[model samples]
Target chain A: MLKKHNILVVEDELELAKSTLAYLTENGFSPFHAKDLKSARKLLKQENFSAVLLDLGLPDGDGMALIKEIKNAKNEIGLIIVSAKDALDKKIEGLELGADDYLTKPYFFPELNARLKSVIRRLNLEVNQEIILNEITLLPEQMRTLIHGEELELTAKEFGLLLYFVSNQNRVISKTTLGEFMSSNYADYGFTDDMVYTHIKNLKKKLSGSGCDDYIKNVYGVGYKFTVA
Target chain B: MKLLTKTSLNFISASVLFFLVGSMAMYFSVRNIMAEDLRNRLLQQQNEFIYTAQQNKVMDLVSELVFVQTTQNKQLYSFSDTVLITNEKYMLYRKLDFSYAQNEQDYKVSILLSQSESDKLIMKIAIMNIGFAMLFFLIMFFVNRHSIKSALGVFYSTIRKLEDFEVTQSSTLSLDTAEIEEVKKLNQVFEKMSAQIRKDFISQKEYTENVSHELQTPLAIISSKADELMQADNLSKEQMEQLALLLETTNRLSKINQALIFLTKIDNRFYTEGSTFSLNDLIKEKLSLFKDAIQDKNIKLKLDLLDITHVYMNPYLAETLIINLIKNAIFHNKSGGVLRITLSNNTLSIANSGGSLSFSEKDIFKRFTRSSENKKSLGIGLSIVQRICDLYSFNIAYSYADEHQFKINFKK
Candidate 1:
């Protein structure tokens, strides 16, 4: 059995922290929450965490200080700043202080999941980089995929969407979430619902044609769910 | 007229009028006093002639300047001016005629006094008066001009400093000290006003940032909660669709809030850091960002870069200016529409194939004015573009012939 990753969510907003913690738990990770910088510091000392989702604004102090603390420690812990401020300077400063990634507020859980997993993957270099679900094998680093021991061709955007789906499986992802993800990762283009629909259709066609079991299913005509069962 | 010139002119004109009237009065008064002395001398001479005629013969007393005339009737004393020819030159005299009774006979006695010396004295006095007045006026003109200029020194400096004052600058407005009461009061008022303005400006900036922070946290919470509810398997299709709508509405609201904050920042001149860069390269780079959208819409892009124009502006604003314009053009375009961009002679023209607006053309750049078909558009892009152009004094125009066209003139 694979060991679960320990994630720390540092947020001041109680409701937001509760939702984030629940989301983290549902994604197969052991999660801890700290509502302020003082408690966060205490939690950091008592536990071993693989990654931290740090909100820049905390009750006691700024989360930027925690970024430095985590980076300076002997153990490697992935740091991701989740800030309400979309200020460019703050983003640059967080990254410069050893944060692995940054996410603006009102973020999608799937988006956060992808960034957290990517950060953890980067920090643990010896961990296997391939994601496998039965007949499907995805080599994320090389952007290559295989089904039943046969190479499958996918475009860059298709490969990105597949990776996003695999990371966030069995959950209904809304079209708005998918659209935001597509626009942010791709050229910041206005990704319409039709465009997202087309890309998913093409990706689904390619996956089924390669003799792989269909994993992606539409949920109530509102969203798509990548079911692995 | 300048204040100094105005004051100096007034002083000079007043002095001239006073000098003219004073010299004339001095001349008349001096002539009267000299004529009175001459009349007294002539009277004393007439008294001496009457005594001489009483003692001796009255005709003998009339020599060169004296004259005795025999008259049938006695005359009262009188003085008259007479001219005599001596050595063929006319000489003026003051003569007094009086009647005298000597040796039981009536005699008319006349005494003459030369008036040339007194006339010469009056001329000297008039010349002296004028000379002294002119000198006094010249001195007063210089002193008056210098005093006024010195008094207004603080006022001029205040004006110069005000001309260079920018609210974005972090320095306080400090004015020079003044001896003049009015100028001192004026400086105090100005200093107080500037301080108030700075305080208001700083508070306004903080309010904008605080609003963004305060609202975004709740939005984040709401969105997360809705996203969680959507994850439930027991929800019906109607519930799921409603959840989706709620999420999209939250997202839209957040976008509108952010756009308003950004507009306020631009209006407040927040992005003042500047650099010089090539517009052509910037357009090309931004176009690459929209390449997928263009392909999705099947937009036929026609780009003509006739020159490498280097524009000096805040790099962030420049990027926004180009992005907003390009986004507006692409998003409003129809399927299989032609998107044409041309840059030449310090001008940029972006045209897209779209039908004429259902609304008024003048309202195109107004905020929140969008077509009925594209309800998804935020409608603030063109407004932001117009604001940035206005900040730099660039001329922006929108026109429609066969397509919607936006042209910008970058020349000052």
Candidate 2:
């Protein structure tokens, strides 16, 4: 069994901080909450966390400074900065200072989950992937995707998107979320929902053309759901 | 007021003085020249009179009698014991009326001359003085008027431009060529100053945008990692929910920052013009991009696009304006609401069904001004739209017709 990772969330807003703590616990991760840099630093000194989710604005000091201190301490902890300051310079500064990811406010919970998984994967979190679901064998690490014991050739975008859908199986994924996952430069690329339509269209066509039962179902006026039917 | 009045008074006084002095000098010189000529003629007349009387041989005693006579009236007097021989007396006698007749080269010369000629001489001197005074007055009037007209024109125009100047409107009151060199120089200075101010304004706007852009990546990392952490296994339900909310807030914060930075860029005029593109085509393309969002929100979009060819504008700015307008309509509108987008003759209008905006008509174009009711908005959307309109010289107007309506009239 893979040991669950621990995360430290530093946020000033009490309600928001509490909600984040709740969400982390429900998702099977232990989270330490801190309302300021001082408490966050104390938490850091006391226990080792797999990653730190730092908010840029803190009541005591800047969260950026905390990110720097963590990086400087030579701790192999992954950092993710949560800030209302979504300016390009702040983003670059946070990332340049060893933060693994950045997230803005008012984001969808599911998207946040997707981003969290990506970062964890980047950190090489140990997890068993050989799972048998009926006739399908899923091996996430080998990047081998199959249906009915036959390999399906999929584009890079298709593969990433499919994998994301598989991870969040049986849940409705919004097109906006799909676009975000498919695009590296989401803001600049103008990846609108139409682009999502085209990609999804291609993915569906390819899967069906490969003589595989279509698991991708469009939930009209919403998004798509990947499930074993 | 005092300074101007004094200077003008001095100028008038100096002109009057110059005229007076000049007329007086001319009058005196003319009088002296006339006196000398008259005296010389009278002396000659007196000598002729004596020579004629002597040659004709009147009584020797009588002929020898020296007489002094006034030339002005021809009154004679006998010098009982002395001869009248002084030039000064001859000059003084010429001042009186006198007459003399003599034959010179067969032409009888009758001369009646005085120190002052006829009354016409006085009138001529008066006329000459008056003419000179008038000439001086005209010169002064023209010079002063020219100086005043040029000065006041420049001053008033400068004030008008200052009053009417819009930051978006390039300074139209150019000092490139002025009638007065000094005014031209001043305008040049003003032009340089205004240019510098404009440059600084643009630079600061760009700096804000660039700074925001620089901040985006780190924010992405932080928010993404937080999100990832929220999804890991074996955590309490409360902790999981808390991480989830953190991730959501982070995402919204990141968007607001991005919007702010982009707004700054638009405000600073940091845009590039690409190839001429069809407004209709661009709008269609943008609408397609929002297809998912529109569908997801159940918003019905109706696009009334004209088959126009192209518009010469910064494509990026145009796109931004359109995107913001559409996005605003989408975000503020109720689910299943109607969104109408019309593009005709380069004019684009977007109307959407939504709650009444809490802002006044005036504040709609201002930056960071969200409706009082909606705190979640970054408030930079319409401001960005306004900026793009300004850059392209397009006309933008907003109206509230049960729903929010924004219209942009593009200029070629």
Candidate 3:
């Protein structure tokens, strides 16, 4: 049995925090919730968290105040700033204060999941060198993939889409979610439904042609799902 | 006209008018007084001549200035002007004529006085008056000009400060104190206005950020809830499709909101920090981000970098400007259409082989003016592009002949 990594979600809104906590728990993390900066600080002192999803606007104070404290206490802890203020200066400031990543609000859960996993994997490089799903093995550190112990050729974008799906398996990802993922991850402005479809088609073809089981499935003409079973 | 110039002109014109009128009045008054004195002396000399004639013979009283002549009838005393030629020079005289009887003989006596002496005195007085009055006016002209210039010192400084004032900056407008009441009042009004504007600007900025936070947090909640619902099993196809639609609409609304905030920030001149970089490298870098989309659409990209043009701009805005333009060209292009980009002589031209706009060409850059068929486009990309260009005063033009083209001139 694998040990569940502890995740801390610092958000002021109760409903948002509830949904995020539920999502994190379902994704195999031991999630804890804090509605304000004081409670978040108390929670941090009580538990050793593997990652933190910080909301910048807190009731008592700015979430930026806690960034330095959290970073100085531990370097291995993965911190991501989840802010509604998408200003460039704010993003730069958060990153400069040792935040592992920055995610604007109204983010897709799948995107968040992928980024959180990537941040953890990066922090614990030796422990998580590869992601193995049956015959398919993914070396995320090198952007390398193999099926039946043989190397698979994939483009950078194709690899990113596959990693996103693998990180969030057994759940339906809407076309809009996939489009936004492509747009935000690649910093591309105009990502259309057709582009996402084309990229997914190519990635699925490459995966199946390599004598690998078809894990990715199309769902109800609206979205795609990567079914592990 | 400048205030100083206008005031100085008025002062000069008034002094000239008053000086002219005063000199004329002084000259006439002096001449009148001299004429009256000459008349009074003439009367006194007539008395003297009559007394002398009574004592001696009337003919003996006749001298160089006095003349006696026998007359048939007695003439009442009268004064008249007479001209006499002496030493070949014309001389004007005021003469008094009277009739007298001496020892039963009737005689006419004439007494003459030269008027040239009083005329010379009047001229001297008139000249002296003009000289003194001119000196006084000249001194007053300089003093008036200097006083006005000094008083308006604070006013000119106020104008200069206004010219340099930028609402985006955080500094408050502070004006110098003035001795002049009108200028002091003007400065007070200006300072009050600037402070109000700053307050409004700050509140507006806060409002924009607040709106983003207020709307985005709810959107996040909705999206997260819908995503959570998607994990449920035993759901019908219709329910799943509806959930997908809900999530997509929520995402769309969030995007529109964020884009609007970005547009407002640009309008408010929020991005001010800048650096110089090469356009060629930036284009290549941004194009790589859209390579997959270009490949997916099978658009043939033609790049002609004739020069390594460098531009000084906010790097983030520069990136956005190029990305938005290229994305528009590629996104709007037909399948297998040619996307041509050429840069030279501080100009960039991006052309795409796409069908003509369904709407008016003039409306192409307007926000939310997309074709009915292409609902995926946010329609704010071109507007953002135009705004960034407008910020830097770059000339941007859109045209369509055989293909849709966007041209930008970096230099004005």
Candidate 4:
């Protein structure tokens, strides 16, 4: 059995932090809490955590700045930022700063748990291979995905999108960024946010219909995040 | 006339000075030359008189008589040949009787040396002619000054008008033919520049407004979500408490950002051409979207809307205007107050019962001008309304009675 992962939740609101800790603890993981950057740093110095849930708005300093510090101190540790900042640029910046995932505020707790697990699984991967989550197995090399031990058919673009999501796993992806990543000929193909939405809708239907648990959650006004609960 | 008068005065002064000196010099030179010639002639006559007196005494006597009569008196006289009085005071010559005397005897002369009274008469005549010439020069100077000054006045006023022209608040300044060709060219250039600048300013304003407006909805969602998350009970107590404050601050910042971007876009003229859509339909849709808020406020809405939905305008801007206006009414209205909205024949009017407007009718349309009591208000709603009207050539008017009234009349 994999060792129980240690997770640190850095936030300011006491009730929210306590509830988040309870949620993490109940999900078979040890969770720690810090109200500000100072306490978070103190906790980090004493313990090795598998992942850190960071909020960009902190009492002491910016959450994004702390994300950088965490990455610098430990390259292997997974970092997920929970922010209310929904701008495309901010999302892109957080991800680029070595965050394993980003979740906008007011998120459902199950979604957060799912994302954390996804990040942990990706970080633990030793070699490129098929990822097995519940009944769904995604083969990165073959660009094929299986649900309930049955090969699922996906369109070329749909396949590519699913693969990219699986590759990134827990991260919140913006449509603009995803559009660019999935196709080099987006302009020629007249790709738009609506098209991305359509593809995501279809991808979600296929996964669920094929007996695969729903892993894609819409982040409202931002984009989608693929993770396992 | 003013320019002409000024130029004429300058010309008159200069010409007067020139003519005064010129006429003086001319008169003096002419008088001197004439006097010298007269004196020389007189001397020559005197010498001739002596020569003839010696060579032909009878002819000399006749010449002397003629000279005396011409110089000394107006009266004519005759003398006898035997009267030879040659004192210094007078001269007598032989008198000539034309019928009986021989040719040598026919010439008779007399000389009278008398008073200088007659010399004044000759000098007076010369002075009169000089005076007439001076008067003529003065008249010519005044006439030229008057005409030239009038012409220059027209030219100067036109030039001044062109030089001090402003393009923002007014239409093109009228130009008359009195303006010189160069000035006319300058006026044309100014008109063209003003038109181009106006065009460019409008387009730039529109672009900024559109960009800012486009960015607002997404930002709002981000901020609201963030706030909700921070308030969620799922987080650890400490984490939840810390994030709540962060969320609030972020929410305020995002609101400011949205307002600023909206104001910037509105001011920059980022208006797109609107398609014909039912104003009534759009309003109904918008109201439905705000249904929850309307219910929360317990405000009664009275909409006397027409079936007409076709309005030629940028649908986005029109919708924005309506949203802001309705939102403003809802926020400002008294609890359980009536909100009235009426649309007819390209006119949209909204009125809500509430406290008197926080600003004068004029101040209401200026950006960032909120009611003094409502410090939290961003104060850009009415300005956005005004901007939409300006961009689409709509006429907007404000009035206050029992409640504030905003009326917008769209151009066909």
What CAPRI class is candidate 3? medium
Q: Give residue B347's lDDT in candidate 1 (0 to 100).
A: 97
**Deviation (Å) of A195 in candidate 2:** 7.0
- Which stretches of candidate 3 lie above 4 Å from their native place? B35-120, B149-156, B177-186, B304-310, B344-346
How much lDDT does each candidate structure score? 0.89, 0.67, 0.91, 0.66
Mark the regions of model 4 whose C-alpha exceeds 4 Å error after superposition.
A1-229, B1-246, B307-309, B372-376
Q: What global local distance difference test value does model 1 have?
A: 0.89
| Reference-based lDDT, residue B287, model 3 | 89
Interface RMSD values for the candidates, listed in order? 1.1, 8.8, 1.2, 14.6
Give the winner by lDDT: 3
Residue B57 of candidate 2: its Cα lDDT? 35
What's each prediction's TM-score?
0.85, 0.49, 0.88, 0.36
Error of 4 at A229 (Å): 15
Which has the greatest TM-score? Answer: 3
In order, the candidates keep a fraction of the true contacts of: 0.68, 0.05, 0.79, 0.00
TM-score of 3: 0.88
Candidate 4, residues A108-171, lDDT tens digits: the string is 4545665686677678673355777678777754668788889999876677677666655554
DockQ of all predictions against the true structure, Cα-based: 0.66, 0.08, 0.74, 0.02
The better candidate by TM-score, 2 or 3, is: 3
Model 3 over residues B318-370: C-alpha lDDT tens digits?
99999999999988999999999999999999999988889999999999999
